[model samples]
Target: AVAFCESVQPLEAVVSLMAQRLALAEDVARYKWNQKVEIEDSAREQMIITKLKAQAVAEGLPEAWSETFFKAQIAASKATQKQLFAEWQQHHAAAFEGVPDLNSQTRPKLYALMSELITALHQAWQPLQQPECQPVVDKLVREKLAKPGYKVAGEPLFAVH
Candidate 1:
């Protein structure tokens, strides 16, 4: 994950720089055109500045905030997974209601499968943020895996069914 963050850092930097340059160019063009700086022009320029600054801030945000974003995303994904897992548990239990034992191993495995999906999602989405979320994401992944029955496979944690 750290390696991935490092790799994306340069890409994000380039993207930010390009965006800033574009904003600056637009401003310069407008100024050069000198079409009478009216209220509308001021508003437009303000909008551009806002956008550029947002991009810059996103690119330059502290690593901790990026981590929080990652963790929050992970938490959201996990919550969804947990919900699906519960639904699976109910349906499967009902399906084999009369059965003595309907694959005890599958339940836990399903949970773990969902966890793995979220982990992969985090890895894939982490780069979307200008800053890196690797450190927090990595820690959060481990913390999630530590949960009991998370490693076991059972009903398939995802709703792919």
Candidate 2:
């Protein structure tokens, strides 16, 4: 099981990055709200997906599977943003002051995280298919994953099933 755990380490890192990105979404949502911008930017999302697909191919991971995993990350981030926005609105929260520029401050950080995630995915791809991977991932997620002020719902992005 040591090898199994080692193999899934990269996958765990990817998930940890996802969690970090979700935490960043709170800042993103606040920035968007302050700027009067919509949270769902299809064009930007498509661009990211396209870029990730190409990167995945270059890194020896299947493009389709990589895209699916990336879509999950995008979906999770958006869900977190939506939930945060709703809560803020419900509370009649005051507008956030001096929000950082999304393009310069936020997107750059997210982009860096994406790069790390892609690298991790490439490292984990084959080992992720091992029979022991699922249970080990479950254990690690339960024991080691940080709670980043949001729930991680939906399917495990890299799990076999």
| Candidate 2, position 153, lDDT | 25
Compose the digit string of candidate 1's lDDT tens values, residues 1-161.
34334444433332232222222222322332233222123454344344433443455543343333323333433333354445545765322222222125422332343334333333344353424544433333344432322222111121111
Mind sharing the TM-score for model 2? Answer: 0.83
Instruction: Show where candidate 2 strays beyond 4 Å.
Output: 1-8, 141-161
Tell me the lDDT of model 1 at 85.
46
Task: Summarize candidate 2's per-residue lDDT along 1-161 as a digit string, tens digits.
Answer: 25444476676776677677766877899998887789999999999999878987888877777777777677777887888788888998888987878999999998888888878866776666776676766665555443333235225453543
Candidate 2 lDDT: 0.73
The lDDT for every candidate, in the order shown, is 0.34, 0.73
